[model samples]
Target: MQTLVQTFMERRGDLLTALWQHLGISMASLVIAMMLAIPLAIWAARRPKWAEGLLQLTSVLQTIPSLALLGLLIPLVGIGTVPAVIALVIYALLPIFQNTYLGISEIDASIEEAADAFGMSRMRKLFKVELPIAMPQIISGIRTALVLIIGTATLAALIGAGGLGTFIMLGIDRNNTPLLLIGAISSALLAILLSALVRWFQTAKPKRALTVFGVILVLLAGGGAYSAYANRVETVTIAGKLGSEPEILINMYKDLIEANDSHVKVTLKPNFGKTTFLFSALQHDQIDIYPEFTGSVLETLVKGTNPKGMTAKQTYALAKQRLAKQEQMTLLKPMKYNNTYALAVTKQFKQQHHLKTIGDLTRIEGVLKPGMTLEFIDRNDGMKGLKKAYHLNTTAKSMEPALRYQAINDGRVNLVDAYSTDSELRQYNLALLTDNQHFFPTYQGAPLMKADFAKRHPQIVRALNRLAGQISETDMQEMNYDVNVKKQSAATVAHRYLVQHGLLKGAK
Candidate 1:
């Protein structure tokens, strides 16, 4: 508990930034939802026949899984804050809409008669009587929507929208319990505070209520204007996949770029789901640069490309050519390490089966059950191609990268697909099964950047390229171990590496 507190205190600045981001996204989403839902609810409340269908439609939207909904929106709206805010607004609609409809519809018919008797106009009656009486229910609906948005906003990080979810996802990837707890607890506290604030607003005097809302409006307008201005500035945005390696690499890029160049700023949108997500983000100019592997680019992104028998250099060259031609993206210098996908088994399991190669899995056949990440399970160059090459038949299940090691160790699964640079392979006493069939290609790590950005920022590119041949396989494995097994932060390990390599001066 003390460690957790210390961790929170150490990262308080980041937490506060995430908190502000969370508030902005959530509040903006709730405000939009209320605007749309209130009008729709009023329309529905007047039409008895339409109310049921309208309510059911929103209820159905609420039923879609939050992550699934975010994924679905990516292709349509692309990644980042827009899709996140849109998804949150969609999720928040049902509660607010239903409450508003109920509040207005349940009003006494005699009140309408009283308003008519007083020669009140329809709009005047709605504003003067119906809305005023419905204020409490409307406020209650807003409170519910606020809490819902706050909780769901954590998921916005998956799509590269900054929020407290960034810490939670980072903690999970690195297996740091303190970081995870901080993100979870802080988010809960924010929700609680916001809920209390809304309730207070419900009961507060008119002057106080107006003042609070006035302040919120001012803040919102200011935030929106600042965001607009920031977007126009010449900033290099680096994105990364969801793991310690990408996080480390992106941070290294940020540090190097900022150190070398005073005119431009570098920012990170870390943990942006998968390779496809990052690729899409780059192609759409949602991100300026991100670390990618040659093998993944060849096998997954560029469809129907056969990379068999290609050397690492050939693969890198091919990836560079193809990405430049197709996506207007350029691959920078490759790192020394090949963080390729490989199968691994517990030492005891390996000993029991005498499995030395991926082909040896054929001997175990029916006895082998493999667990891997979803991308590995579905990729053409992953299990599917490996199985065809080795002529092996085995049951495989899709699991998260973070859980695969534990599942293998616990005997829930016998074999697991792992990254060659993962630290857990050593800590868990696992043995890598060699790819004797040569099904999987070498994954040389490199930064994929927008061609225009590269052309404009040559010095920044030069600064990043200085790291090209520096990080060996052992260096990456040790860094991963430090983060995953030793529970060190990725930023700390990255900083140490930068300083040790003399890549940065006075890195603390």
Candidate 2:
């Protein structure tokens, strides 16, 4: 308990920011749902057949997985708060709509007759008699929907939408129980408090309740507008892929840019999504820049033909040239590390099997079960390349980068693909097998952006390139270890590295 309290205190600011984001997003989504559902529900109550179809539609929406829905929204609307709210509103609509419809349609016919006998008009009866009588059920539905929204709002962070889910996902990625518990427990508490508030609205005077809701809407709008205006100097959205390394790198980009240029504001979208998602976002101008890899550029993004025997420098040069000519993208100077993919096994497993090379996995063919990431499993320089070059193949279960470590640690799998600079390798005491056949290409991390954006923002490019050949293999591994194992903030880790390395002057 004391340790948890200490952790909470240390991360109080971050926790509060995430909680506020979560609450605002959830509340905004619920309000939007209420607006859409109330009218639709009234129409449905009038036409029973249409109401049934509307119910079926919302039920189908409920059946769609939240992550899948977000994925679908990305291509249409891109990411961030927009898609997050849309998904949540869709989920919230069903409950609120159903409840509203049931409350109105199922009202006692005796009341309707009484209202008609009193000469109460249709609209008057709806606002006065029927609504007052059905208020309980409507409020109950709102409470249910609010709880659902609060719980699910955590996933919003996965798409660069800030929320408590940021802590949860970061925790899972770094294997930190403190972060996971903080996010989960906070979310549960938020749901309870908000549900209580909704219940209170059931008893409050209509004018008072409406006033409070109006105030909330105003606050949300005012806050968003103010934030936008404050950050209007020169907004540059910088995104990165999953993992502590990318998060750290993006923070470095943010810190260095802000330190170098006062007018430039760098907005970091850390853990934005997959490599392809960020690349697409860059192409579409949804984001300004991101940290990409030379190998991924060569194999995954460009879809270039097979290239072998290329050194790290050669890879960087080719990636820069091809990105400029083929894709009209800019690949900035890479860092000193080669964070290429490698296969790893536990020290015990390596010793037991005498595995020194990737080919050694063939010795345990049927016995070897490898845990890898989906991108790695499918990429040409990953599983495909391994099989083509090493003549080794196994039934590999694709999992997140973090879970692979957990699987190997728990003995569920004997093998896992890993980045060269992954701190988990140090934490887990795993042995990286030699890629004697040189299957994986050099993965030099660099700042990637549209060539036009690069040309326009030469200062931004220069600020980012301050890191060129600066961070070495050991430095990156330790930084990852700090954030992933030592439980440090990416911003702090990044800022400290920059200051110490003379890449950044004053902390922003």
Candidate 3:
């Protein structure tokens, strides 16, 4: 409990920023949905056949899983607030549109006859009679949408759209209970508060209610303007995959770029998403650069890339060549470390089973239920290749990276597939079994950028390239440990490393 409060206090600034972002996204989505759905519902109510199909369509859309919808949107819109808001609008549409249609449709025929007898025009009748009677139902739909939008807005973080979900995702990745609770609790509270505000709006005098809503709209507009102005500088945005290592590496990149280029401001979009998400952002020019692994460059980015017979240098050559030729992206000089895939087990489990190599796992394959990542379980260089190469038979069980560690620690699983340089290996004192067959590709880390960006900013390229052979395996692992286990900030750890190595001028 003390740790939870301390974590909340320490990260209060970030929490508030996330809260503002969440509010902005949720409210914008709700307002947009209201504007679109309410008008459409009114028009459709006059045409029952069209109304039935359109309302049904929204129901179908609401059925699409939030994560799946975000994934689909990434390829089209790229990742950010735009796609997040669009998704929320889709989900919000169902409730608002359906309720409004039903509300206006359910009004008594006598009410319409009275309006007609009084010589009310179509517009006046709707404003004075039909809509006023339906106002309560409309308010209910809006309230429901506001709450739904608030909950679903959390997913925006998956695509680099910042919100409270950032804290939740980071907490899960780092296995921090406090961070998880903070995001979860904050979101619940926000939803309750907003729901109550909607109820108040329903009861308040029209003038007063409109005044408060106007203030909110003005504040939102101001925030948007401020964001645009802040981004007007010469900014070089660097994004990374989800992990402490990627976060630390990007911090290193930001420090190097800012140290060398004064006119260029560095912006680090750490833990933006997984490899595919970042790569899509790079291709769409949404981000300026991101650090990528050589193995990943060939594995998923390009087609027909075989690194089977290639050494680390040979593999990098293939990846760098293909990336430049096919995608017009520059793969910079890689770091010296090899963060390739490997399987691990607790020291006691390893000793008891006498495990030494990939083939050795076959001894306990039947009883083994190893917790692995979904990516590793599906990849050719991961589980598929491991099984074919080593002839190891075991049930395939996929899990999140962080949860894998927790499972092993809790004795739920005895083995796990892991990156060779993962900090958790040292943290948990796990033993990495040897890959005698050497099936995994070399995974040297390097900075990747669009060719156009490189051409436009040669100084940034040169600055990032200076890290080519600077960071060794030990240097990276220690840095990871610092951020993951020691609770040190990635920026601080990166700066210390840079200063100590004379990459930047600073007191160590």
Top candidate, metric lDDT:
3
Best by the TM-score measure: 3
- Candidate 1 clash pair list: none
- Which lDDT tens digits does candidate 1 get at residues 1-508? 9989888888899898888888889988988999999999988889988999999999999999998998898888888889999999999999899989999999999998999899999899999998888888988898899999999999998888889998898777766789888889989999999999888988899899999988998997898788789878778889999988898888888888888987778888778778877887887789889999999988878755574789989999899898888878789999999998999999899899888999888888888878898889888789888888889777688888877887898889989999899998888899999998788898999988888888987998898898888898899999988877776777788889999989898957
lDDT score of residue 155 within candidate 3: 87
| Cα-lDDT of candidate 2 | 0.89
TM values, all candidates: 0.95, 0.93, 0.97
For model 3, residues 1-508, the per-residue Cα lDDT tens digits are 9999999999999999999999999999999999999999999988999999998899999999998999899889998889999999999999999999999999998988999999999999989998889889998999899989999998888788889999898888888889899999999999999999999998999999999999999998999899899989768889888889999889889888888977778887777988899999898878889999999989889877494768889988999999999999999999899999999999999889888997898878777878999989888889988899999878667898999998998999988999988889999999999999888899999999988888988888889888888888788889888988888888899889988988889753
| Candidate 1 residue spans exceeding 4 A from truth | 224-233, 502-507
Task: Candidate 3: list runs displaced more than 4 Å.
Answer: none
Q: Which candidate do you rate higher for lDDT, 2 or 3? A: 3
Ranking by lDDT: 3, 2, 1
- Using TM-score, rank the candidates from best to worst: 3, 1, 2
**lDDT measured at residue 333 in model 2 versus the true structure, 0 to 100:** 94
